[model samples]
Target chain A: MSPSVAYGTDIDERTKAAEQSATDVLTAPDIPWNLVIWNDPVNLMSYVSFVFQSYFGYSESKAHKLMMEVHKKGRSIVAHGSKEQVEQHAVAMHGYGLWATVEKAASGNETPGKGGRQRG
Target chain B: MAKAFKYGLKGISGYLEPAERDLLRGLLDDVISMLESDVRENEDPLAALIGLDMDVKQPGDRALLRLLPNVMKDDDGGSLEFRQLTERSVRESKIGALRAAALGLDKNELVLTPDDATRWSMALNDVRLVLAERLDIRDEADAEHIHSMQDWSQAEDVESYLALVYNFTTWLQESLVQAMMAARQAKS
Candidate 1:
């Protein structure tokens, strides 16, 4: 008596892979939102950074970088995450007295380049 | 006692400048009284709202941080402008000092916040350092630092100023949280 081993199917690896990929995409958070802070006549920049750092637990350097983005670019995306995550951050920022909001993130906007502006 | 976020713990105590000390004492008392009254008169939503708005306390880095601007305006139209500047230019010491003086405060009167001089000075210094580092104004002439906003002052203007800033901030803060929540909801 001979026992034969049978491999069920090698016919649809590609299809299975595609299905997995689709499911991953579906489960992922869609519509990236930016947590923006507008420039105001009140609310000091340092205070803004302090808020960012204290509320979000951002490092001093990270907080300052975000603050400058708000100061120079007129608004900033301090955090990027699922909608609920960003909303929580916005509320925290508000609590700290910084004007903050979340909006649809622009496409292809990569993270800060060159790090600091290297200003004199 | 151990605290998670110890924002306002001054090392030196009770060294506030005369003007600043008086302002702190006055604001502290008024806010406290209003809050207490609001608790009793919770029936009035507006009053309660105002009290909640005024109850904000940042208490970070040793500076007695209070949220919700409360400026009082008078027939003469003074002080609101000064308080407005103080809120905006929170990081500048020299400018804040000058601004305080400009708004009818004598130099000596603005010397030290009587609440706790060492702590107050340290907090002020910390604010100054942070501002200097973060403030990359294209040139030295960029807006005369932070306190330039206060060119004048009035005694009663604090409440009105606070009211305006509070309303705007509240709206924005609410909107921001809502929008973010909506996005989150959509995501989930």
Candidate 2:
């Protein structure tokens, strides 16, 4: 039998699969999650930028750029980190009255149908 | 008077004259009453034992739903349960903030503890959300249209009036956030 196969029954295939899963878990930190803020009709652009600057410590210019992106693009990736970290961010944004969500960064490009009616 | 906010080691501070304060007080009170009236004691003795209440129906109002978002987008059952468990606390916190703001109105000066500052920020955002819904404010042009009309006397247009309130609340909320940020920056 090949070195890849263990002596026991179907355990060899199961072992390889488990090993692959373990490797994926070990590399998981590199696969970042994104905290996305969706535009709302109610939230002011200036207020959004201020929240970005206040909570995230982003500079004025950077915050403004992101705010504009959220306005024009309907959503913006505001932060990137592990799942727990991004979830915390999304909750905090919700607390600040902005619509927010977290998703795998690799899958961030998928845009769900917009929720609220569009504002200007 | 133009609304403004200031920050220091003493905490965040702002001024509102009697008329302005009254207007704000009324607005806060309105939202608080709306949120509070939604809750009622759980009638079932069995349910009461576990701290569950069926009286406060889940908020069917769009504005209320917006204020309380689901934790999980993928799981409908989980999200509904989460909202059921959390709706009361969220409404209470919102009411608490409005009351905190009301406390400062009589004095014409509002001073918030760091914690209260955060609450005020959140509460102000809620007020704006409610008003925005009423105004049908959908984007920059809508806001600008109202801004352009601010100088005119729109005595008949209820939306025009609500728009003014919305704009003022936005300024107030922005100032609070900026003040908090400045204080944080100073600490570092």
TM-score of 2: 0.71
- On a 0 to 1 DockQ scale, where is model 2? 0.19
Q: What are the lDDT figures for the candidates, one per model?
A: 0.40, 0.70
Model 2: per-residue Cα lDDT over B94-131, one tens digit each: 77878887776777677777778777887788888878
For model 1, residues B88-131, the per-residue Cα lDDT tens digits are 23323323332332333233222322222222222333233223
- Chain B superposition TM-score per model: 0.22, 0.84
Question: Top model by TM-score, which number?
Answer: 2
Candidate 2 C-alpha lDDT tens digits along A1-120: 011234445878789888978986797668466778888767867678877766776666777888998999898877776666666665567667788766666654643221111111
Tens-digit lDDT string for candidate 1 (A17-106): 678679757854573755667664445565666556445556557778888888887777777655555555554443344555555556
User: Residue B95 of candidate 1: its Cα lDDT?
Assistant: 34
Best by lDDT: 2
True contacts kept of each: 0.02, 0.38
Which segments of model 1 are wrong by more than 4 Å? A1-31, A109-120, B1-14, B17-19, B28-188
